[model samples]
Target: MTKRSSPAKTGPQHLVLLAIDLLDSSLHYPGDHPPFESFHFDIHITSKAEDEKSQVLVTVKIGVHNENITRQLGSLTINCTFTMNNFADVVRLNADGQPDMPDDLIETLHSTALSTARGVMFATFRGTFLHHAILPLIAPGSVTEEKRL
Candidate 1:
């Protein structure tokens, strides 16, 4: 009888967690607009699992408060999970053909946050500032230096 060989293990040894806090003084346009002092915005990204079998999951949360309204605008949360393989592919290709590092990963996340905020601003506040003005300020930059071959 022939012996069967065991399958090789593949994937990230440990999960990575990234947190970014976005502050927007101009979340609402017009300084005279009702002040929302209790509003809070937070985003969390987690590399749940890595390997041939699974992808990472990212969770986002936004909270707002207004003492005058019936609804206090507690917290609005959204979760997005994407495959590691897909992420890897995008990071490899930038505007120019070059190999990018994990820093690119954060940039992608920042872009996603901006997009999400824009969608929410349009739907809820009917505002145009989040996308045009606020997002640009909070966008994350490349955190690490690229290695030379």
Candidate 2:
């Protein structure tokens, strides 16, 4: 028999956090384009708190997949933090001892979190990777691009 896993303590929130950050991004062109193929990538998120702020780490991994095998192009990651100024305002304790985050507040939090992540991305890309040979061809106009997936 298989045992079920326990639920998360805080559960899931409806208001998704749209954030972006770039960490140590690089370009590795095989001197030319490999082949016509679809792009595949994955995103990972983790959060931690230090002092008055909570650090949200977002990592993006990109790989090119051909008929034979998949090869990693590169990766971008952003290290950001969200400080809870008013914990009670952001998260309320319900009668059942569960945390209740309001819809409006959740939306606001999402925007702020995303902006914070983009800030680091902007700086790193402009300062470090702006003149990369293969960057301008594939890179977006802005650091954080808002596109429908």
Pairs in steric clash, model 2? none
Model 2 TM-score, 2 decimals: 0.39
Question: What is the C-alpha lDDT profile of model 2 across 36-72, one tens digit per residue?
Answer: 3443443333332232222222233222223333455
Residue 12 error, candidate 2, Å? 15
- Relative to the true structure, candidate 1 has a C-alpha RMSD (angstroms) of 13.0
Off by over 4 Å in 2: 1-21, 34-37, 53-69, 88-149
RMSD to the true structure for each prediction, in A, is: 13.0, 10.7
Question: Model 1, which residues run further than 4 Å from truth?
Answer: 1-47, 50-52, 66-72, 84-101, 120-137, 141-149
Q: What lDDT score goes with residue 122 in model 1?
A: 42
Where's the lowest-lDDT run of ten residues in candidate 1?
1-10
